[model samples]
Target: MVAFTNFAIAALAGYAAAHPGEKHDAHKMKRELVARDNAAQLGARSLASCSNSASSQALKARSIKRRANAVKNIRQKRGIKAPARKDKRTLEDLQKWEAVNHNMSGTYNYDMFTSIEEVFSGNTSCILAPEITNGPYYVVGEKMRSNVKEALYCDGIDLFLEVQYIDTNTCEPIPAVAVDIWNCNATGTYSGIATEGNYATGGYNSTYLRGIQLTDGDGVVSFETIFPGHYGGRAVHTHLLSHNNAQVMPNGTISVWNSPVSHIGQLFWPEDLRAEVEATYPYNTNTVALTTNDEDMWSILSADASFDPIPQWVYLGDDISDGLFAWIQIGINGSADYTEDEYYGVAAYLDAEGGHSTGYTIGGGGNGTGNGTTPSGTPSGSLSSALPSSSSA
Candidate 1:
């Protein structure tokens, strides 16, 4: 029931009049549809290509970022310096320097022995007394006037020694150095079995006389023991010295063992003490204690002067009834300055018995009278003598 407009009615009437009963062009319609589809496919392919290009560019950017990060890390590590490593080396150097110097640097006075060769050559001028051996008949008794409560009927005065060394510049202590000591007991008996004995018998184990004590860091050492006894043919006396070894070289440098000897000489006791000790010995049966200055051994030698008796500077003090104690200070060169040449030489002489000389004794008893057994159960005479060289090195 709808009525057509004039335009629509006219168009339909015109189309029907112009081509009445004409067939449509189906081939042309199909060609036009196929062309339009091809254009649409081309546009889609262009868009797909653009998307793939953008993805590739993004991946390249990520790769560049990773490379930049890696470079930055490398630069940072290389630029940094390790201060801790340098500091560790510096600390090690400082420690080595301290050990070498021992803090000494200056001129110091010390006693030098000129006749060391003569002393070791069996020269009797330095010998206080000839070595003695027999003492079975010597009398042992208590004297009311004796200084010590316990007294042994012997020929020598008992001597106790303490030796030490110090750095003059810093006043620091020295270690592992050597010390040599020699003394006569109340009746003129040597500490070692260098002679004979009546009661105790002279021996290395006999504590009555003879000892060596090394100093500690404080530069102090104390020997709590008896004064030496005297024997016939020698006067009351004591001798001591500090010693060290050095290395020798065939050429270039001369090195000292960095060890120095100081304060060498003998010590004399009061006349009263000498008289009391000498009054009870077998040597007293024939002779008396000679004046220290008058004795041939002490007279020919001045303290640190002549070869006789090797005069030692003594630090005299109150008499010890229980034991005689003595000490001395020595100056030594630290190890740092030592060279191979200076470090290879022997510092002291060997005893007549072929032992490294530390001291000497005239007579009292033979070796092995006292505690002849060592802690290791070896005989004291046969035990190894491996004491340290210096108090400090």
Candidate 2:
């Protein structure tokens, strides 16, 4: 009842401030997620306590070097002269050079590339509680892989994503945690489910733009993907789910049936970046009306002083078309568990035959006992039986 009320309020608010082509309806209500409902549901060390720690300093230095090297590589590839290196760099100088050479006007501020204080400090302090509904399109037991981009029917600027997980209770990195991420392609359609408005090349059998990766010793996981496109009534975003003690099946999917979900949240990009990217090909071709961050209820509610859900990013080269490198720290309650969450009832889990279906119509609804079959009408055999699971450790 409370969730419905929140949805009602958000829907009303969204209607009052609808954008030029946005339609507020049942589809809009699906995004009414309130992740931050109470204090116990959140945890993260105060910035002042660890902002200057040795670990943080090392992280900041490594991040800076990684971005600088990326920029240098792009320049080298394009036959552009490399900028002179400096022992100490200033934001003003960086911005001037980027503006003159990269045409970064109307895009994200140059400071976001250099002054990544938010990235270094990390916003992982705000853990997403289990009670919050995962996004409407979330599928369990996705393939375990770093490259989520299948390029089947999607095209846009490349996005190399790196995510670091931190335990809120100890303010320390938590390695070996399974992180699941999925998003729509440049045309605003998701894979792994038979949904309306999806591309002909996408459906229950397709796994594009959806995959999982385990964090390394540093609690980091990287992905090669394309920037996500927007849909009606929602801002551009990516959905994420974290699992603790989840095992990998023989067919390379996660064992979500028994694993406890530790966190469920969405990551957002700066509007400036989104606007510039959307102006490009394929993305600009999307017919859905653009939804700004301020107008989206999730974006509005996710904003708080303790954490910044947006990732810190850098352009791969002098132009937005060259692609991007983005990173963020996500905070999670390492001990919390939501194995019985109601949202899991509709998950399209994996079968031994490499099929994913829950007998439900996916984006639509029905009884959960239909014959398991791929979108191509191939019988997937009986439901998946328990299989051996793998671990990062």
Best by TM-score: 2
Residues forming the 10-long window of minimal summed lDDT in candidate 2: 95-104
Worst 10 residues of 1 by lDDT: 101-110
Give lDDT tens digits, candidate 2, residues 207-320. 788888877766788887888998766788887777777666576655644456677667777766787799999899988877766556555445444545667565655567
Residue 13 lDDT in candidate 1: 33
TM-score of 2: 0.71
Note each model's CA RMSD in angstroms: 50.6, 8.0
lDDT for each residue of candidate 1 in 11-40, tens digit (9 for 90 to 100):
333322111111223333233324423432
Candidate 2 segments exceeding 4 Å error: 1-37, 40-42, 45-132, 197-200, 249-253, 343-346, 352-354, 359-365, 368-393
- Stretches off by above 4 angstroms in model 1 are 1-163, 167-172, 178-182, 194-208, 241-265, 270-273, 276-291, 304-393
Q: Alpha-carbon error at 141 in model 2, in Å? A: 3.1
Best by lDDT: 2
Model 1 lDDT at residue 128: 18
Q: Please report, in order, the local distance difference test score of every candidate based on alpha carbons.
A: 0.30, 0.57
State TM-scores per candidate: 0.34, 0.71
